[model samples]
Target: MSVVLDISRLEPRQVLFAPSPLSELAEMLHVLSAPDHHPGLRAWATATATGLSSGLADRLAEADFLWHATRADILLPARPAATLAEELDALDERDDETFVASALEISCMAQYHRGVPQPLISAKDAQEARERAAIRGPRQAAFADRLLTDPRGVRAWLRRLFQDCEREFFADAWHDARTRLYADARHKTELLRRKGLAPALTAISPALQLDDQQQRLVIDKLVDGAGTTSDLGLTCIPTAFGRPHLVTMITPGWRPVIQYPITTPDLPRPMTVNLLQARLEALAHPVRMRMCRALARGSHTTGELAAAHGLTAPEASRHIARLKKAGLITTQRRGRYVGYQLDLNTVARLGSDFLDSLLR
Candidate 1:
């Protein structure tokens, strides 16, 4: 489905690229809940100690398994509060009825085939969704039954669940990642001021395209909602983690919210390799080759790689460092653990350049 965002009349100031820790928390929970869907995150969760247990993990597990029904819009309200403290305060003060209704709406909406949030805003549309209910999980079906009626109870349970997760699973990581996101936002803001909207936005994600003629910023598979920035401006936030990104178009109306992944480095890097044999030698070891294949599939920790290879953590790390120095693999901080992914481009260039030189 396509998300048509009407940015036709938006001023430079109308579009703000900010950071939201609360938003990132929801995405992080989703990643934890659905490991198969988020392969890279799965590796991180497997390698790290999340400290989530009992209620919080179980609830997130339930919600994640029922993601289609537990729509991110319902869990995230996508509040555009300036700070995490402000956002937390707002969420804490949110009344029972509104909170309950949103939860129920999301629970009911999860039964449908659509992934967008716009259709669930109306009573008629929600009723239509209920009529066409298509759910796969028994736990979710049972929970939805209770959620449809006793929303207040379910809402309370959710508040407790989130508090547990925030304290146990997310608090520390949230602080560091939030700081990075804030810096990312500030950098984008400076770029927007210097280079204007289109250039700055494209820099955020090459997938973002501003069509002035249609007054739309098109992002392929970003969301399933068509939104307009007629009144309130658009807020684009740099997320440390959302892969493929997420968009919030809670109409009637809030400022359109875009949460895209900060996947690439902000600045260009000089080619750092001193010798090509270093790369070839790094791959010569069978242990390193296994790690490379594992990293190529997704991301891996030195610990996980060690366990797989029957090596100690220090031994595995030594090998990993050699590969990193060779520019064959690179590390990324994922939650509490560091993950490694292969530098396929460098690997290809090494092979191609070597063959070209020999032929010459």
Candidate 2:
């Protein structure tokens, strides 16, 4: 006997809450589109003005890279000849506000560096140096003392300090730089007006395509309000595995939003109290919770998860299958192994709602 499945007959509520491998796909998209800045820096800055981390500095560097690359095609003049590494080295050589400013630029560049070793110093060391320097002020003597004790710490501390300075003294300067860049792009377009670039600027098309199934998945996410316009703005391109992916920022509203090729969008909409409760209920199972935590770390095959959890391979598969059905996890086959990863963006939203409810 043959069993026939009718997907179209499924109700919206059923599909929305059902577990499916597609859930993970949605989660990956969310991470890609979220802001590029390190959320940790924002959290730390709000909590303490003095604590510092080299990791945070590195993140700032990567963000700078993104800002630059996103606008690369425009043929704007090069940012002053100084490279991030060169600027850092110069800062290490000097002991003045000029050095601090240079360090800040390096930090911004570090924010965007893909594979470089992050924040040259440990957080504890950076924090201590920040404290000492804050109390002693920006005198060369104090700066020297901090540097001698913890060069990495001193640099990280200075980077954070300079970020505040930039916000104060150079905010307008950065704004003007951006405006000039745009104006230059427009000027170029006007000069080349008869050429196709003007019409190309009108309505941006999807840089990629989605298969019918992927398109339907995206439509469902958008309709359920699980993902916002910003999240779904980019067209999904085909990956090496033939799965759809997106990695470029697409304009949605006034902001340019980055979309991750293999991730889901974390919805910003508030979850209803009932929905929050239901999500928590879904997560309450010990087996499910373990599965969620594991997926958060990265993808794993059923056998690998079973081995890690000390369950029989079939039992582990059953549990994962359940989670997939619940829309809590997703699996992809790679040769002999089917890898599983969490639907992080959805989990994050649900987790945020749970936390908010508790606070309320």
Candidate 3:
């Protein structure tokens, strides 16, 4: 059978009337694959192909094909604002880590797919990252230096990189998709209240529902917003892109935390060791680890993370939740959205300690 036949003639309810970026990519791929097919699709695919490496284009083609056959669900809209607020209140009443874990999972996936670099910070990047660290306090400079010199230390420091990406991607896609679905601001808000992320309006919807804990977490974030502290202890505001906002917070000891005003859309800066530990623990699931490696560059939310990593949102969420529970990262709120960032300090320290033990 032809590859197109692989896609069912009866469109799945999940995809009916919904714009599928993946499908669009696939149609383009099919045209590219068959020279005799529609000339328009072929021309579009060829044009897009010019910007990508052959390997990446082939991977995207495979992804497009897989998406067509799969019945994966998408993120759901937020519940009614009142109910969401109540749910969040209930969540705060309980100290269980489940909701936090879920948030973390989303964050980890986001980071793996979208967060920024904490590599063996080049002398240039290192010097600047360290200078920022000094303003936070005295010990931070040494901490930054240790992270640069040690292999395990650097890896640990950079682990949250993935979570950051996950967070940003989720927010951007959700907002854009939701806005397209409901053009009116008041209606969009109302819809967000009903569904959780963005309300689904289509007759055939693939929107996933949020549990009570998830609902509560979203409520708390929506009302409070999220922000991070720079290495110098100055609060940095989150830019629209998210990851670039937290890039300034690369200090030691003093890591970023989720706070109101939602200044920066990136994750908190935890210890390098914490990040490393989370990554190592998360590595037990190779797929999650692969996702993490990808996010080291910037933030991506659940959907983008899944698309990039070639996994479903739920599957990716599971791995990300595990990373969050390990205290390797944190999440932030952007409008009715969430984003992730690395806990650089904790991860850096953990990495340095591990190296010390190994050398001993």
TM-scores for all candidates: the values are: 0.62, 0.25, 0.22
Tell me the lDDT of candidate 2: 0.38
Runs in model 1 deviating more than 4 A are: 47-50, 65-71, 75-79, 82-85, 92-107, 110-134, 212-214, 222-225, 248-252, 266-360
Ranking by TM-score: 1, 2, 3
In order, how many clashes per candidate? 1, 34, 73
Candidate 3 structure lDDT: 0.35
Misplaced by over 4 Å in model 2 are 1-278, 353-360
lDDT (Cα, tens digit) per residue for candidate 1, span 1-360: 456678778777887887775677677765665556556677666643356565555677565533432344444535556555566667667664455345555444543344333332556654543443335456655565455556667666766766676787567768768877888888889998998877776676655667766468776552465677887877787767566445454443556677777765642322222344577788889888777777767789988999999999999999999999887887899889999988766765566653333334
Worst 10 residues of 3 by lDDT: 1-10
Query: lDDT (0-100) at residue 108 of candidate 3?
Result: 20
* Candidate 2, backbone clash total: 34
Best by lDDT: 1
Q: Lowest-lDDT window of 10 residues in candidate 1? A: 266-275
| Model 2 agreement with the true structure over 145-246: per-residue lDDT tens digits | 444456567567655544543444223333333343334334434533444322322211232222244222222111111222322221212111111222
Alpha carbon lDDT at 215, candidate 1: 64
Alpha-carbon shift of residue 234 in model 3 (angstroms) = 45
Q: Between prediction 1 and prediction 3, which has the larger lDDT?
A: 1
